[model samples]
Target: MLYATASQTVGPYLHIGLADRYCDDLTGDAPGLRDSRIVIEGRVLDGQGAPVPDGMVEIWQANPNGRYRHPEDERTHLPLVDGFTGFGRVPTGPDGSFRFITVKPGAVPDVHGVPQAPHILVSVFMRGLLKHVATRMYFPDEAAANANDGVLRLVPPARRDTLVARRGDDGALRWDIVLQGEGETVFFDI
Candidate 1:
């Protein structure tokens, strides 16, 4: 009898070896070109620190030129990744962890010429919740940019870090946000 090493079966993913094979999502490198880039992963846990197995998490970002991919956007030259959704959805695994690979979004302007701010849009849906929570994720380290950001100003200085994400490696970065718990992240009316 022969057994495979964990690395052989799971690559970098541990413990969940073999069981952690890829889903049918178009996340892997493609034949022609790969629009799939940058993975953001985190666990969604409850107040008691248990994983919420059933929920949906969505992330959206601007294009490389500080513009959105929406037709209504007036940006004349925002670069767009061919297949990247600018948005991606992920359902939690058994442990309540999910992951997504997408191209990093660019900053969008607030008043045409002025770049409004750089941010990522996050939407999460869970059972029993009356409505989905809409929120903005910002970068914590960018003090200068964040200070001038319209959205970041809404959050008090001491607690602003909760909304800002960290830059890691060459990927989209990582974060763990909460809807309603101790020290819940602020949600915007907009």
Candidate 2:
């Protein structure tokens, strides 16, 4: 008789072969963007608020003109920055911290052509989960745009704040991910 294989969690060794691909600075090669550059920093926390130091975080976003570098983003009218890739991946440090340097993305349209709030698509991969969790990191200053965002409306008002990153005194955007328990960061089904 055939038997099913047991499920395995995401990682402890994710960095082994992926180290060469790690890119924390999306702005390193890109220059002369129309929008201002921004720093996004965050930590991955567990149920009891302890850090998950071995996780990986990845982000995808549009350029300042709201156009992705990928061919699938067929809005040819929107100019693409010469060196902007619109994608980044980095591993959590010993303190469960990760940082990315990039310009703030512009609003992209949904399938219906309605504009979405300026946000970065995020994916978290860590141990204790068979699949990665997906979420969005919205800009705190884009309150008006965020309020009208179709995707943001899908999340309850009370929990919506979890998706918005807070601007710290140092001016870097900070967002924390809670795997479970009280004050958990919202994860989308996708």
Candidate 3:
């Protein structure tokens, strides 16, 4: 038939084949769990400020030592953590909230060799989206470092707050994603 299949969006049934397991616990019993376990929690909201229950969120970051588990990372100076994969995927609950338990990531050098702020790469997949949205979550505590971050510096000052996660009362980080609205989170083109 030589016809291309139509593109389909990730609907409410994403959990079935994508991330059925409790994939959010990146530090569960892992060797690197004892030192710096931290929780990252947030909700995914739609344009009208309603929850997007069926969405899926995925995150990737370097270990505490700033070394990635991927083969493409060829930095010899960075130390890799044992038993830490630095990848997490979680399906949003009925309230559109997602959480992950992982160690605080270390700062990685930018393309110009300048140390960037500690951050996690996030991807959001949901119904009606032909492609997932990409963003970065920066730790709120790293204000100084974030100011010098190459990517953060490029973002308009007014919109930079959307990318920084706030520290909760219990010490966990909180960062919500607003897909569309007056305060929409800043998403990356990549």
| Highest TM-score scorer | 2
State the local distance difference test value for candidate 2: 0.91
Local accuracy of candidate 3 as per-residue lDDT tens digits, 103-169: 8888888888888899999999999998899999999889899999999999999999999999999
Off by over 4 Å in 3: 1-7
Model 2 quality (TM-score): 0.96
Candidate 2 residue pairs in clash (backbone atoms < 3 Å)? none
> Which residue pairs does candidate 3 place in steric collision?
none
Ranking by lDDT: 2, 3, 1
RMSD of 1: 12.3
| Candidate 2 local lDDT, 52-151, one digit each (tens) | 9999999999999999999799999999988889899999988999999999988899999999999999999998889999999999999999999999
In terms of lDDT, the best-performing candidate is: 2
Model 1, 45-67: lDDT tens per residue?
67666776776666777755566
TM, every model: 0.72, 0.96, 0.93
